[model samples]
Target: MSSKLANPSSDRGRVGMRGLRASGAAAALSVGLLVMTGCGSSDSAASSSSSASSSAGGEHSEDLKLPAGWKHAVGTTDFQGIHAETKLPTTVTDATGASVTVTDDSKIISAGDGISSTLEALGLKDKIYAASKDSTSPAGKDAPEHFEYTKQTGTEGLLALDGTLFIGDNTKRHGSVAQQFRDAGTPAVVVDDQATQSEKLQAVADYVGAHDAGVKLVDSVEKDMAKAKDTVKDHGLQGHSVIQITATGAGGANSVAGTGTPGTEMIESLGMTSVGAESGLRGLSREFSNEGILASDPDVIVMAESDYQKWGGEDGVWEAFPTLKETKAGKAGKIIVMPDAQIRYSSPEIGAGAQALARAISEN
Candidate 1:
């Protein structure tokens, strides 16, 4: 676990999408505006992989003390190949209320890891041409091309992939590109930045022609949540306070999850309190502050593995922010760490993320 820490693939989007987007950057793995946007003949065969792709390098273990019902995320999310689309050229109304008729599920680009990871849970991992880089996760870890959600770029990257459709998160880049990708023959289906986890899952699933898979994926999320919360309640750990802290990359901008964000929802749903939420930091995501942390004095301090490493782990965090020593979590040494991808991306992995977090809390 110590050896596998990769810097976060992208910054924790400060915007409404929760670190999935960068100011103007593009995260084009593959997507296109097809029939609705007059898509050109794009030798879609060029984009399809002949065989199923596996994680790049190899699967890195987080060494999580997973709860009873949860399995390791890699092979388990494939749904046993249950893709249930009935027709081609299906019309999908994306998060933006725009319609796109997808012609090829064989060639797809997940503009963000949210879509990539969600699609992987839907058993469509083989169809993904690329995914966000450094997404050490339940899925998209092996997506050959490193997808980036920061720094807006031109359509050269999009056109090169020759993908049939692009699934993106609603962000500055995703929103501003409605017609850019369309004009490039890439029909983009942007998922709402603020959609619930299930809605986000259903959006990408629908775009990729996996409505049935989407339902199952959503159900898995719900069941996982129920199990996770039960574990917390069973362990007598409900309402424990937590604050997930993440850096931009190694030693980058420090941020904390607040109210209305996936991190908070996951925490509260598991019957715990988010320090940021308790303090009324309503930005959904907000800057990390030593004074604020001391004020709320959470029960546990959650950190992304990369940030944990950057700060030289628990001992280092205590030294750098000596103020942490005054907090309840610090006095008890309840510092926690998890994979960056699970906590950062609001995809199917979130439930698994919560379960892992729950397991950690029960231990604490």
Candidate 2:
């Protein structure tokens, strides 16, 4: 697989729901609110200030105020739009230098991953510019108005970026955006929405200024996975299998199943078995299947939470597949409803998604 296949889509999804344009969101993460405030819509026309320093020569590291338990890692990278130098941790050491452990690999990017959350964590939320290109979630169709604001502002050049995070399938429409960043000297971390296990999470770390961020994310995932494994044992879900079907393209109501989809990944991550990697159901009515109205014969069924509600939740899925209620997963009450926000393309959120899946599988 291409490296791009393992990366998240544009950083837009990281803040797509809460607001923040494409490049702007990333720029927000890269540059910070100090430069982005009031610059999203009607340009503020303020003269450039030099508050941000480059990661070169460790200048960025000097300004950071990390969490009480956090410390600088071996390496550093520019974070947010501020180009503030940030470092990741070298070891999972706590204050006592004992290694911290993480279990699951369900990836998640909270508001804390990009500009919006970083600023808030650091007490700079009020300085956010809130401008962004159009963004649309599975729950909310139609991309928002500020979809490509980062590209519009030439953020790629200003921050001197090296990588980006993408959430969905690679399309020319959005691929061009990645290309734009690449052309401007930045690599991208792309992930498909159908990706259930979020194995591609490391791509986000590739862009994080600190190697410690990668370590932290990975450790967190490991801890979550371990917890999931325990949950599976507690629930006796061993040797179970599952599948995920998805519809791609505009209104092309057809269905197909694949190993790449999120639901399948979720099953495998929990140590459950699955059908052939290439095996899947395809070609259903995009109108409904896209919302998960279609059914598959798996031990468990999982769908985006928003789509679950759209499909009428458990009642709707049961009505659509009477057999589902009879299946091991279903009878055992294993239907999973994922948070729509977790479905988007953010690095930090990948861990959160993994945790959710672990919880779903272990609990069910």
Q: What residue runs in model 2 are displaced by over 4 Å at the alpha carbon?
A: 1-145, 148-177, 180-199, 244-257, 274-296, 312-333, 341-364
lDDT (tens digit, per residue) of candidate 2 on 247-364 = 2212321222334444345456667654323233221112222112112235655544334334433454455444345645556544444333232223223334445555545434
Top candidate when judged by TM-score against the true structure: 1
What is the number of residue pairs that collide in model 1?
A: 18
C-alpha RMSD of each candidate structure in angstroms: 14.0, 18.8
Query: Model 1, which residues run further than 4 Å from truth?
Result: 1-78, 81-87, 147-149, 152-156, 249-252, 259-261, 278-288, 310-312, 315-322
Q: Residue-pair clashes per candidate, as listed?
A: 18, 77
| Candidate 1 Cα lDDT to native | 0.57
Task: Pick out the ten consecutive residues of candidate 2 with the lowest summed lDDT.
Answer: 28-37
Estimate TM-scores for all models: 0.71, 0.45
User: How does each model score on lDDT?
Assistant: 0.57, 0.33
Q: In candidate 1, what are the lDDT values of residues 1-364, reduced to their tens digit?
A: 1111112234531222222223322111100000001112321111111112222111223333322221222211224444545346778887667777778777776776677767666667777776656565545666666655445555566657777777777644576565566777677778886667778878777776667778877886777777778879989997787876655422234556665456677888888877666554443343334444554567887765555556644455555555556878777656655545446556665665677677667766
